[model samples]
Target: MRITVWDLPLRLFHWLLAAAVAGALITINLGVSWIEWHARFGLAVVGLIAFRLVWGVVGSTHSRFASFVPTPSAVASYVRGHWRQPGHNPLGALSVYAMLGLFGFQAVSGLFTTDEIAFSGPLTRAVSSDLVATLSRLHRQTEWWLYLLLGLHVLSIIVYRLRGIKLVGPMIHGRKEVDQTVPQPRGGGVLAFIIAVGIAAAAVWLANGSWIPVPPPAPAPAW
Candidate 1:
């Protein structure tokens, strides 16, 4: 019963990322004028992903990959029966990794995609048209998988809620019921904020095309 489940920063990151992703989906589905917001939301996803990669290394115990990444045998064992752990169980851990990897892929690919018009990725021109087309296709295709993963995630949460577990409340409040004997984790909230803000700023810079300098066109041929 005694277990530290989630760090505050990790919880906030989850909910905020969820909101941003939802906003991006809405804006993209709307069309035209909303592209700017959509692009910005995509950038935020990139930043959050970057921060998460770093956090996975130095974050709180429960927030680190080592804490949840079970071996095949361990996962098999979990699948066969109950884990009953305070932190993420084997299936939950797999979902975590899947979400992180998919989001990371989607965000990175978005940077090379274009609307096939005046609006294009900041670095799209830096790469080849073939690559751009590939990235664009990938960006479009990944949305469906993201939706599937999100649907499963929500369904799992609903199941937990029906079973009398307030999973959403813990995510929002950053607290959960465990044992008094087990100590709560010490987190890097301030550090996490700084990293998130810095990454977001960098994302904005890239999204606004500040990094990719334009090259001069070739000189006209002699008459």
Candidate 2:
């Protein structure tokens, strides 16, 4: 039987987040000229993460956190090869949570970073210098962690493919073929989607430091 395992919003979120993350990584490495783009991508990530977090609550059954949050017993069951059901498995759930958390931290912390040159985060001026320095250091350090996680994520996809499971297709198309009967996904209707979009837009606005009142242009330089 074929079933809808991922809703459209979730699928869009997955791909858009991937693109934003990639853009951030690439632009950041391209030197000062690309820093602005890197910041733009990071802000995009902030919105995407915000949307996903909200969607995880009100999204369709399979996409909800309640559907696949990893429990100790569930992990044990998966390890013992007795775990069976659709959507994220217990072990995969751990990776999902870890990626979300790491990316969220990265995006939020980036709001305070400064290159001490041509680029500065939107929130850099709002925070103390010491705090900005600390966050900047952490941001640089944690970047490697994201790379590690990304590598593992791709590796896992490859491994699953080797085991005759097609993970990417289902995510792209939002459906899967399974032999066992499973309940159809529900929830995440228009109202829930609207709420999610509103939250995400607000996050982008905040991440851009739009709430911070801009200082009036300094009075024309005194002669």
Give the per-residue lDDT of model 1 (tens digit) for 1-223.
4344677678878987898889888998998888888888888888887777767766786787787877797688788865555677788888889998998788778888898875687678788999999999989999999999999999999998998877788777666676345656755567766775677567657655676778899999999
What is the C-alpha lDDT profile of model 2 across 1-223, one tens digit per residue? 9999999999999999999999999998998898999999999999999999999999999889999979999999999988878889998999999999999999999999987988789999799999999999999999999999999999999999999989999999998887898889999999999999999999999889888988888788778
Clashing pairs in 2: none
Query: Native-vs-model 1 lDDT?
Result: 0.79
**Which runs of model 1 end up more than 4 angstroms from their true locations?**
1-4, 80-82, 187-208, 217-223
User: What are the per-model numbers of colliding residue pairs?
Assistant: 0, 0
Candidate 1, TM-score vs. the true structure?
0.86
Query: Which whole-number lDDT from 0 to 100 does residue 110 have in model 1?
Result: 80
lDDT of each: 0.79, 0.94
Best-fitting candidate, measured by lDDT? Answer: 2
